[model samples]
Target: MKRSLEFFPVQLFAVIMGLSGLTIAFAKAWHFLNINYFEAIYKVLLLLDTILFFVVFMTYIFKWIKYPEAVKKEFNHPVKSSFAAAISISFLLISIAYYDYAPSVSIIFWWVGAPLHLFFTYKVMKFWIEHKFEVGHINPAWFIPIVGNVLIPVVGVDAQPEMVNIFFYAIGIFFWLVLFTIVIYRMIFHNPLGKRLLPTFFILIAPPAVGFISYFRITFGLIDTDSLFLYFIALFIFVLLLTMFRQFIKLQFFISWWAYTFPMAALTIATILMDSAYDTNLTYYGALFLLAVTTLLVAYVTYKTFIAINNHKICIPEEE
Candidate 1:
């Protein structure tokens, strides 16, 4: 009760991220495949995602009020600080999910999420500049802030001017390149990620996948050499991760496992978009395969999450 409220984690917002991404992925599948069941599933998930956003947001709000120090500690934390952007990313994901069904409400979320995400980007970049973080502190989760920037254009193309969307798109793509190098370098030169953080390796798939989707949105669905490169880069990473499946399967679950969901959703959506543009059997079947995987992974993670909650495994003191 009160203890749980005090221990409520900001990272819990990633659940909304996973759920919102699943909703949008299904919505895209319905649009492309015209599958009747996809529509109902997406609609239900959207409503549930909306409800969960407020629940997690309000819980963190109370936690912030009661334990400002805890909130501040997370904000200053090298790894946890990256997840603060998940709160803004959740809002943006909901905006994209609602764009078709409720544009008016979607714009309101975009308006709030866009600016807040920019603020987080600035705050995090500033933190990195001011603090003396070791290479050991870097991980794929660092991509979270950068990924949110490119995502702006998914709905921003219609909600705001083209230049505004491009502004965000540029920031996202550029930083993604910079950070990708850093993360890869860290992995090659330093120790491998710990068990709890290993799942965040999946985040490596997000920036390029989201970049592909955002690029098409900014260009009004104009497929070109650059767009193909972005999509393929993401696809290659997805395949690379599959080769490591045995490694991932052996690890114990952590809240960070939610990191697996949204990026797969982004890549699934990108594959669907490529199918829509090129009308190829390869992309079409690829999209469906990825969609199924994303759905199953999200469901499994959600089930594990609830079990952890019920067992009081979550919202307890952090493991050393």
Candidate 2:
């Protein structure tokens, strides 16, 4: 326990991000399809997501109290620092989940999460400006901070004014493009990511996915050209990553494997929104397919994660 506490990582919060996303994805399914089964699963997931969030949040707090230096080191790490945003993103996602069940509580989380994420965005961008980084340091995880910004409008559309959410939406969309270019350059020209970090390639699907949803929220659920553009870009990346499944399957388990979950959830949710708009058989079945894939993917990763934890594979020192 001491060893685990000493090396406890901020990336653990990604679990909350993934679970929150899955919970929301199912909630959307229940809302649109009116499937009683999905509704039950959605409620159960909400309960479990709430509990998991507290567990991960409290554990990280303990780690911070006991190992402040370790926390600081990760906060300063070029690659790892981006993951710290997952903490705020978790808060934002949980806020989205609770919006229907409890608006007041949702607003509380939104208030806490939105500002904190902006702070992280500022800090991370400042770090980028202040430091000199090699191309090898770039990866899809760099999109995390921007993804959090895109997420604001999901719940913020209801919790706050339009301009506020739009403000965040603009920032997210612009930076996503910029960072997407840089990360793609690194992937094509530089060496491949380590097996452990390879799952982050799935993150390439998130910004546009979340952007599609946020655009829907901002436009009163209207499917426009821009929304279609965002959705198809996300869909293309989703297909692109699927073709690499053989490579991903061969890699050993790493906590970084959780990277596969939230982005899948984002695309799943976006597809569900698309179904809501089109009301076509193809969109409906497509959403269902992606939802099943997202759910099973998350379940498998969760199982592997627990196995790794039981075998004492997580929360130990790494080579960085």
Candidate 3:
């Protein structure tokens, strides 16, 4: 088999777009540190994230079309490829809606993309279970898109309609549970160490962390003063922090460190929103400290990521 430098462009494009989205997300969080600039920064970040999503999705689509068989063979299940295509199309539709001035296309894209993304998620989960892939390992590759879709309606775009919110949240929670089960399984069985541990730790903790926040926000207005949603949010937050501490001690630092920005930011926003309903001071402080530490870690990892990318070491070799 022959390898060429041509493979690097696609990977480079994906990484650049992904990191740009991360940078925007982190900027939004940094702005929140002052409170006064939060809304402005958030709006900017949301727009930037949407753009970044489009670029990354386009890159993936190109790769899918270019190397269909190769990509399909990477997964044990064939449905995974179709589901991935569905996700890319959904994101593309949504991104176009965000930029389009006409109401008809915007509404059409919104309606189409939302349901397709949910369906894609369902199929993906089904594939995971049927194939018996170790779901609990918490790798960043899977976690990022899950969290991104959940946030797209909440933070990256306008508030979704109540019906849409309920639909997405319900489907989102179901998929999240599947992901959670897999992560816990990996933690128990694999006991991942070294570099693998970093992405796995983030994948394990961040989904539930963000899911809890999104669920609370969606249910906040409709529910009563003493709703179960609040309790669920609190419980998930507790689990997230506990997992973070354990992973930190294990020294699974790079991906776990840099990846905290998006999750912690979402948690902080949720805490602020639920301040009146719950005692959120600890969550607030915890998110703040984690955000600070994650910034420093991301800076270091970023330098390393750049070197690795240039040297074509971004994709890890699968163990025998």
Candidate 4:
């Protein structure tokens, strides 16, 4: 029993954030479908998300208290520590969903989450500068901390001060461009991502997708040409990444595949939001197509997760 009590790594919180976001996206898609049962699934998934937050949050808290070295290991790891940002993003996503029905609870979480998120971002940036890591060190995962800040405004408009949301949004967009340039440069001049990290390339799609949604929400539903530009940029990179599907399939499965889920879901949600805001028929069809694709992909990940667990492929100490 004590052996079983060992905490799972905090990095695994990425799975919770990804699943919660996907659940919310599914709810939104169902709404677009005009499914009478949409509200039922939406609420059920929101409850599921809340339960997950508590479970994972407590699990990691146990690690923080019992296994200080584990936390140190992650924090010092150049690649792994940034994933800690997932915890903050998880809170933000849940707070966004929570605001739909419980404004007070949502506001409390947002106030707490936004500062923690920026602090985490600051630490990661500090680490990067101190280490003086070069362009060759860049990866899709680098975006996790920065991109998450921009995501704040998704719920910040209702939960945080306007200027606070704008500040983070500006930081998010600026670093997104800076990091994108470096990541693209590294990919062109260096060797390809190893199998374990290749799935993270899908992360390339997330910034612009989430950016589109955050921009729309923060601008109070403005759908200008700049908005269209953002959406298309996401759409283009999403297609660009799809070309690697076969390469990804040929590689063995790893937990990093979870990296693929949220971006797909984000793009799906962006499609639905674009359609609703612009009332464009083409975007409506596009939203349906993206939703179908996201559903199928998530189902596959779920099937593989159970199989991986039975095989004892997960739930083990990870290599640095």
The lDDT, on a scale of 0 to 1, for candidate 3 is: 0.46
Q: Which 10 residues in a row give candidate 1 its minimum summed lDDT?
A: 1-10
- The alpha-carbon root-mean-square deviation between model 4 and the true structure, to one decimal in Å, is 2.3
Tens digit of lDDT per residue, candidate 3, span 1-320? Answer: 23332231222332332333344334434443444554454455456556755665676567667766545654333322322433433343344323323345445555656556656556555664576544433444454334334533443234366676666555556656665565556657775544543533443444554455455556553334433454345447546656667556555323233343434434444444344344367745655555555445445656766665566554443222
Candidate 4, which segments miss by more than 4 Å at Cα? 1-7, 30-33, 134-136
Give the Å shift of residue 80 in candidate 2. 0.5
Give the C-alpha miss distance for residue 190 in model 3, angstroms. 5.2
Taken over the whole model, the C-alpha lDDT of each candidate is 0.90, 0.90, 0.46, 0.80
* Candidate order (lDDT): 2, 1, 4, 3
Better of 1 and 3 by lDDT: 1
Cα shift from native, residue 117, model 4 (Å) = 0.5
lDDT by residue (tens digit), candidate 1, 1-320: 22366567777888888888889999998897667789889999999999999989988988899889989988999999999999899889999999868999999999999999999999999999999998899999899876679999999988888889999999999999999999999999999988999988888888999999999999988889999999889989989999999999998878988989989998999998898887788988988999999999999999999998887878877764
Name the lDDT of candidate 4: 0.80
Candidate 1: stretches off by over 4 Å: 1-3
Q: Candidate 3: which pairs clash?
A: 135-182, 136-182, 136-183, 138-200
Q: Output the lDDT of residue 193, model 1.
A: 89
- Model 2: pairs clashing at backbone N, Cα or C within 3 Å: none
Residues 168-241 of candidate 4 have per-residue lDDT tens digits of: 99999889999899889889999877788888898888898888888998999787887788788989988887
Clashes of each: 0, 0, 4, 0
